[model samples]
Each structure stands twice: as structure tokens, then as C-alpha cells.
Target: MNDKKEIRNILLLVFVIIIVGALIIAKFYGNNQKERYNISVIAGEAHAERWVVLQQGLEKAGNDYNAQINFYTVVNGKDAREQKDLINRELEKKVDAIIVCAVDSQEIQEVLQKSERRTPVILIETDLKPGHLYSQVSPDNYEMGYHLGEEFVRQQEGKETTAGILIDNDKIAAQQERLKGFEEALASAKNITIKWRASDYQSNERVDNIIGMDCVGTQNATEISKVNNEKISIYGFGNAEANIYYMDKGIIKALVVPNDFNMGYLSVQNAVQAVEKDMVYKNTIVEYIVVTGDTLHNEENQRIIFPLVQ
Candidate 1:
């Protein structure tokens, strides 16, 4: 009876030792696991289809990298104060990284200054003065515009052509740069002249009468083209769903489509890397595709105009 009791006690003691060892191993493993990162994306406009697609890409990257994303947008993308408020809110949230398309580069300066030391800030689609942020992910706006101008010159076929230009009034640096590049490239062709320039498409009286019109944004381009029933050749930026619909109907002659999907995906990926991996993030320039109705059916252009996800 004594021997049996001693044996039972020894067995119980071994079992307790095994249980304690298992708990310690589990705790160590849990502690060593990587923490998921949180990235925030602040776009100029939330409702626009382009930004919507960008959000899709951001989400995709978040999923791919095991990170979470908080996306914010201004009610009116052109309103600097609205964007500034959103930035401040994100800063308070203590996000790991911030990606923004600034409404007004200068207006966001002070807000960015507040985030400089705490978070990794990245610029997308639009650029600002570079000191406060980590890096920028955007297309070469000048190159995109220059390509559109080249297309315009080709369409004119050396005849004197009067073109109307509708520029965004929001003072987005990218838009202004696009307009500048287009103007400079078109100037080289003496046969093409910009006869009218206006911030509002409706305000440009010659929109319908001109040989062609260079629009800076997709919304205005689609609107003017539809309202005029394709009366003039329309060339512009953006690859929104409506823009694609208009292009299919032969309303928009050409579109300078940026790789917005890649922009979003890369921005998030880089942001997460910047935080967790101690990786160096730099300016990433996504390329643009000039899609026309003729080339829209092509496989590569189709991917740009009608993305699979967004």
C-alpha cells in the first residue's frame, strides 16, 4: 500500500511539470509573433471613382501584408481645411504610416509638421514640399501631359487647330503640372493653338466649337463630352468607370490613365515595410497609359481602364 501511494504521487508530480513546461512554451511563442501594422490613407476625395479604386488597392495590400488600413477622405477634395482636419484626426489615432493626396500642398504643411516625428507620411497622386514626409508615390504628371499633347498634335495632322483647355480650379500641383507640360508640348507644334482656357467647362464658351479640348479631370471631361454629345475631341486624365463608359461610346478621344491600383498597393506595402522591416522608402513614380477607343480593347489597356477589382 505504501509503495503504490509513493508511485501515484511521483506520477502526479511529473504531470504537473509537463503542464507547466507546455504553458511556458506557448507564452514564449505568443510573445515572439509579429505584430500587425496599421496604415492610414487620406485621399483628396472619397467619392470619386479613382480614389475608390485606389482604396481597393490599399485594402489589397493590407490583406497581402497582414496589416490594417484606415482610409479617410475630404468631403470636398478641394477644401484644404477639411483635409487638414482629417489629417489631424489621423495623427490623433496614432497610425503607423500615413498616405495622403494633399488638397493644397501649402495648407497641409502645418498639419504634416505635427506628424513628422511620430508617423511615416507618404504622398500619393499629388506632391508637396518634401521635407516632412518619407516619400511620394505618383505618376509622372509632366510625362502624362506631354503624351496627351503629342496625341493632340498627331490628331491635328498639321492643320491649324484651335483647342480649348479646361483646368481644375482646386490648385492641385499635379493638375497644374499636367497643364504646364501639355501647354509646353503643344506649343512646339505651331499648328495647334489653345484658343480658350477656363477653370469651368461650362464657362469655356468654345468647348463645343474647338477642334479639341484638354480636360484636367475625369468628371469635367465626361460631363462636357456627354453634354456636347461628343461634339469635340476630348482628352483628359483619370480612368474612372464613367470615363471608361464615355470612352466606349466614343465621347472621350483619349485618357491619361495612371496606375492608381499599383499606387495604392505599393503605398501600403512600403508603409508597412517602413514600419516593421526598417526598409528605406523612396519616391515611386507609377507610369501612365494613354488609352484611346482604338486601343481600349487591347489586353494591357483593358487592365488599366477596367481594373478587375476596382
Candidate 2:
């Protein structure tokens, strides 16, 4: 009778151990099947060449981070308003986080705030004016602008004494910063003087505005050069088209190139990182590349780029 009782107790202990072990295995399996997080990236427009490189980088990041990332693109040449509306729709989808390449920084900020009212937002490529919200994921365009200023001074070291600024429109932040930075650098150079103009008009009008003056509008550099045959140096975003125009016409002496390819790549990389677990991102700034004589000589070397047509 004693032996039988002991055997029964051993059997009960084994049964209890098996039950607990099975429960632990089941819990581990359940947790492994759960999703981590979903990330969304909004490109202001679909047509720009730079966004193409950015999108690839974004996808790669998603794959590496083990997160679900959807890139939403709108029609090219659409208004910033449309991009904002589309962003709102994505926000409603309840993504874990968002990354935006704003069409118009100021206009886009208004939309970002609404989305952030629900989740964290990271602004990439472009940034809102001070005080709007979120971390900036781009370079110091203003500083790039100042660098433009200093670059002009260095370029004109022993040459002409008169120069000017061509801004794209009063609207773009990068153009404005380039203009400002260029002027500040020229300020200390006694040999050169700068003028400011808008690129809204044609070559004839541009020449009329700055024929005797140095021109600096971040817009239509290629066209602006055709108008201003005077010995003028341009300080604005570099475009391959514009470079060819200037090279053929002998108009632009130097230009500030925005590495759009890299910007696109970095912006998307940031979006991917922000959405991933145990990942982090530091905002990037617009870096400067100077394109001059030999470098801008050939189409192959020029960097005003768009994605390949599929």
C-alpha cells in the first residue's frame, strides 16, 4: 500500500511540470508571431528625380529593420496642397510613425501638426519655419547659403568687383539661405558687390534687372544666364540643364550644387530608421558641391538628374 501511494505522488509531480513547460512554450510562440511596427513615408511629389533615390533607400531600410513601410507618392507638378491632403489620408491609417518630404515647408507644417496630434512626426528633406514642430532631417540650408556667399568671394578673388543674387522665388528656404549666405560672405570682400533679383521673368527681363549688376536668383539659372551676358556669377541650386545653358552661353561662372541624389537616399533612410525598433536617425543637412568649368563641361558629368523613365 505504501509503495503504491509513493508511485501516485511521483506521477502527479510529473504531470504538473509538463503543464507549466507547455504553457511557457505557447506564450513564446504567440509573442513571436506579433507584428512590430508599421512606418509610412510621404513624398511631396512623385515627379522629382531626387525622390527616386530616396525611395530605394527607404525600402532597403524597411527590409533591414523588419518593419512595414509604405511610400505614398502623388502626381508630379501637383500643388503642395494636394500633398498635404494625401498625407492626412495616410495619417488616418494609423501608422506607427511618419516621414515627410514636404513640398512647401511652411504649408506642409500645418498638416504635420495635425498628424502629430496623434503620433510622432519627423520632417525630412525640407523643414518647417522655426516654431512649427518636429525634428528637422536635413542640412543647414542657410549655412549652405552662407557658404555660397563665401564661395562667390573666393571665386571672384581677383576678378570683377560687382555681383548680384538670383533667388528662385521668395518662397524656397534653400534658395533664400543660399542668397543670404552668399551675400554675407561677399560683405567682407571689398572687391565684389551683390544684387538681388527674382527668376520669375525671362532672360530679357533678367538682364534688364541686372545687366550692369551681378545677378543671383536661384531660379532659371540656365535662362537667366542667357539674358545676362554681363560678367555675372550665379549663386543658386545647380542644375545640369542650367549648367549646359550657361556653359554654351558663357554666362554662369560658378554655381552651388545640391546633392539631390544623396538627399533622396538619406531622407528615405531616415524614414526607415525612425519606424524600426532599436533604430535611430540623425537629421541630415543640404551639403554643397561646387560645379565649375571642366566638371560641368559634359552631360555625363552634370548632376541635374531625374529618375530613369520606366
Candidate 3:
């Protein structure tokens, strides 16, 4: 009887040990499966509000897909060389995929050509020339600009109109496309004249009748209006806090806002697909909406404008 009891105790101990070992193995395998992807996202400007939302979207998608994401930001104002170095570093690290918001599409062409064949390359908010990239995710800049132009014409209401356009930079593809569309939209309007168009945002410059082409331009127009105690009819791109503040005060007339959260989310989703499934990604264009002071508070508009919180 004593021998039999001792043997039973030994058997119980063996059973416990086996169960624990099996649990450990399962946990290890689950963790390994969870970390199957390593996606790298590189942005042109780190401090920008739009980029912040983009990063939020990326994090959300990463969590949903059980993938790891490493994000890099370009400081010191959109330096192409800095972006190129970051891309090369990620390439050397052998990251599963790379997402880039190129500062100068032309300048980064060589590095992309070298690294794209090895790893999937995704472009966000910008595009390179010759157009044969792995993928591109951005808003329809031309359509946004054309919509703003249409609003400007509506504001004029058949009256002779004179306006100045404050462009962000003509060299940027997004900005160039926007400007082209705006011009094309206004081509038939003989009564409206563009008095001055420039990239610089001068606080001392006239803002009485101005069409700001971007966030910086809109801010400059607002500051000029504040200094001069004048109400300027400003229309531009972006949904920054300051832009909304000016809109509330009735200083800014209209805005063309991009769905940046979707841009970021889709970029990463496509990147993961490219790496894991060998998927081919085409141009993924994010949608935009026009907002004015009267329509800013609408529920649908608020959702797009404040995507991170939602």
C-alpha cells in the first residue's frame, strides 16, 4: 500500500510539470505570432498637427492588426537629405516595410529606387515623379483646391472681385496641383482678378482680400487681420486648432480639410499587406470636405476635423 501511494504522488508531479511546460510553449508561440510584422513610418514634419493625427491612425491600425510599428519624424523643416538618411537607416535595419512622407519627391528618388526593390515603400501626403512607386496615399489636392475656388466665386456672387493668393510653395507637387486646379476653376471668371500670388506669408502685407492657399498662409492672413482690426475673408487648407479658432471668430471664410487619419491608417494597412501578402497597392486617395463657420459645428464635420479623439 505504501509503495502504491508513493507511485501515485510521483505521477501527479509529472502531470503538473507537463502541463506547465505546455503552457509556456503556447505563450511563446502566441507572442511570436503577434510580432510577425515590423512596419516603419517616416514623416516629413514631426511637429505638424496633421502628422500627429496620421500617427494616431497608424497606432490604431497596428493595434488592430497585431503588428509592430516604428515611426520616425523629420525635424528642422522638411529636409530631403534628413529623410533620405532615415530611409536608408530603416532599410539597413531590414524593417518589413517603409512608409515615407517625402520632403522633396525628386531628391528622394535615388534612395527609393535602391530600397524599394528589397522592401515595400509607401508614400503619404506626397508623390514622386515617373509614378512607378510601390504605393501612394494622399488626398486629392487638385479637387480640394478646385472646391475652394468654387467657394470663392460663390462669395463674389457676380460682383467684380480682386483677390491675392498666398501659396505655401510652388515646388511641392501637392501645392502645384492645388494651384493649377484653382486656376483652372477660375479661368472663365473674367470679373475676378488675382492681384498677387506669392509663397511668403508677410504679416505686414495686405490681407483685405486674400485667398490663403495653406495653413501657414491662413495664419498669416489672420494675424494681419488682427493687427489691422480688419475682417479678412480667408479660405485655405487644413483643420488646425488655430484655423478653427479663426473660423469661429468669422475671420476665415472657408477651409478644405483632408481626412488625415484615414490617410495614415490606410498607408500602414497597405504596407502590411505589401509585406505579408505580397499585395500590389495603387494610389489610395483620402477624401476631403469643405467647412465654414456655419457648418463647422455639424456632427459629421466635427468627426473628420477631430479624428484622433474619436
Top candidate when judged by lDDT against the true structure = 3
RMSD of 3: 3.3
Put the candidates in TM-score order, highest first.
1, 3, 2
lDDT of predicted model 1: 0.75
Q: Residue 58 deviation, candidate 3, in Å?
A: 1.9
Backbone N/Cα/C clashes per model: 0, 22, 0
lDDT at residue 45 of model 3 (Cα atoms): 61
Q: Which residue segments of model 1 deviate by more than 4 Å?
A: 9-17, 24-32, 114-116, 208-216, 277-279
lDDT value, candidate 3, whole model: 0.78
Worst 10 residues of 1 by lDDT: 207-216
lDDT of 3 by residue, 115-221 (tens): 64568888876655534446788887888889988887887788886778887545457777788888888999887888788865454355356777766567767
- Per-residue lDDT for 157-227 in model 1, tens only? 88876777776644677777777778778877887767777767665556432322222365675677667
Q: Say which candidate scores most in TM-score.
A: 1
How many angstroms is residue 270 displaced in model 2 relative to the true structure, after the best TM-score fit?
A: 3.8
Among all windows of 10 consecutive residues in model 2, the one with the lowest summed lDDT is 207-216
Model 3, backbone clash pairs (residues 3+ apart or across chains), number:
0
* Error at 177, model 1, angstroms: 1.5
Which ranges of candidate 3 are over 4 A from the true structure? 1-32, 129-133, 203-207
> What overall lDDT, based on C-alpha atoms, would model 2 receive against the true structure?
0.55
